[model samples]
Target: MAVPGMMRAVEIKAPGGPEMLVETTVPVPVPGQGEVLIEVAAAGVNRPDVLQRQGRYPPPAGASPLPGLEVAGTIAAVGPGVDPGAVGRRVCSLVAGGGYAEYALADHAQCMPLPPGLAMEEAAALPETLMTVWHNLFERAYVASGDHVLIHGGTSGIGTMAISLCRLFGITSIVTCGSDGKCRAALDWGAGHAINYRDEDFVEAVKRITGGAGVDAVLDMVGGDYLPRNLQCLAEDGRHVSIAVLGGAKAEILIPQIMTRRLTLTGSTLRPRTSAFKALLVDEIMRTAWLFVAEGTLRPAMDRIFPLAQAADAHSRMEAGEHVGKIVLKVR
Candidate 1:
């Protein structure tokens, strides 16, 4: 990588709409201590990017405010006290922010090696969805083999990732989606069951699928309207993890029911995690799940790719809820 004074990025001039994402040449960031500079080949579009553009989500301190949370590329430079050999190694990283740029900075510890045979687009899409699924299914919800799990948004990036993960781990996945197409698609990818949520009561459907026993865990992205129903679908001692609030933020859960069921409601955002904690998770996934990628047991499903300049189109597709899998931007 030659010294370039500036690099191309989609800068958010003001938070309002997708049109606010404007192309600009910003100063190329130099990796700081414990950081790595990644020559971003592609970046993944996620919900937080839309929220950031709407003035809802703000980046953490010392982070780039521009949207995009995950990126794949070759390491271009390593910070002081880091191994220089990391430069030029292929990687896809979970980033706090700044992923929309041609170059993005990541904690070296959070960098994930690109699995052999994974395309650049697929690699870029890995970080955000995989991190969310791993945290919710394994850590918070304690999903185990033979456990019945319900996931909302069955065809979106998180949904698709969850479907793949459940299949690989021997858990039974019952997913809910809005349309028949996505429902069938989820089933094809190893979802044990798919419910057309618009036409079916997910609570009743889960009970029927699990032989009236209900589900052991739930991964919910829709919060407001679906809260009570999620509780109803949970089996005794079940864990429900809410990762997003697409349905609305505030909702009520019956206290007595929760106590009787011994259900645990938990959630977390990946970007806010400490570097060491994320490093540990990365190590854990590498040890337990990397073989899936190596053996082709797991795959990153990509919905579409757009040139970096067409970020608005990418965001528009995601916002319209039309993408079946992850949307990626080729940053080059």
Candidate 2:
């Protein structure tokens, strides 16, 4: 299969508001060695995209300038070292950028088959969030069965996924939410207790739930003022993984507390990952997690979807923090 000459894409002209996103025609990218061309059907919206829009984040060297990070589509072409027959298969791929386009290039190793009941939109939403959660929870934090886990931003995509993953793995979970509605949502998703951060301190709530011992691990996206509180909510030998600094990145952490409690703080990003690393992740998902997804135990909680041209509107909505789950963009 041969690649096309050009395709439609959403390009960001400059760092600013949602209005900065512009629709443009760009030459369709040809896949390099070990790569495939994806005829994108949908793309996922994430906080990184918002940060890129605001000029805080930029694509790494040798990556696309476009905003999108993950996409779902049919393979349009396969490059050298890839099976050309793979061109026709349906796949959702993790991308460094350029998923906002009607066509994008991805390494064959980064592509995952669509979940049985998932649409392109839902498939688009899965890669980034799932990769983040799995990497942070199981890989870095090593959340074990019956481990008391505390999750922040209970209504967000990461939070929803964390709640389900914790339940699926037999980890008792507590969550922090901004409102009663979000707290209820987290509870329904299998969280043991929900702290409305608006009305109460999650540190107190977590300590109370843990019988004053505190949680075994914490997944914190809320930084800044929550830093000290997060540490307080962790038990001896607990780990705290911060995936996002929504509040603020800088924090004054207690070194003695970390040493005394034997705590490990770590996090990683989906983008800037080595192809070999992601290939292993894809293999893990296919071998183990695919069955759960097929059985509906592990599934993406899809939210609002917008057409490719409406990327700006979608970004604006997500930045406003009104969404309850993953937001997707239909790139077709």
Best by lDDT: 1
Flag regions of model 1 displaced more than 4 Å.
none
Worst 10 residues of 1 by lDDT: 293-302
Give the Cα-based TM-score of candidate 1 against the true structure: 0.98
Candidate 1 residue pairs in clash (backbone atoms < 3 Å):
none
Give Cα distance to truth, residue 23, candidate 1, Å. 0.9
Question: What would the per-residue lDDT of candidate 1 be over residues 45-132, giving only the tens digit for each residue?
Answer: 9999999988998988878887889999999888997898888899988998999999999999898888678888888998889888
TM-scores of all predicted structures = 0.98, 0.96
lDDT of 1 at 33: 92
Which residue pairs does candidate 2 place in steric collision? none
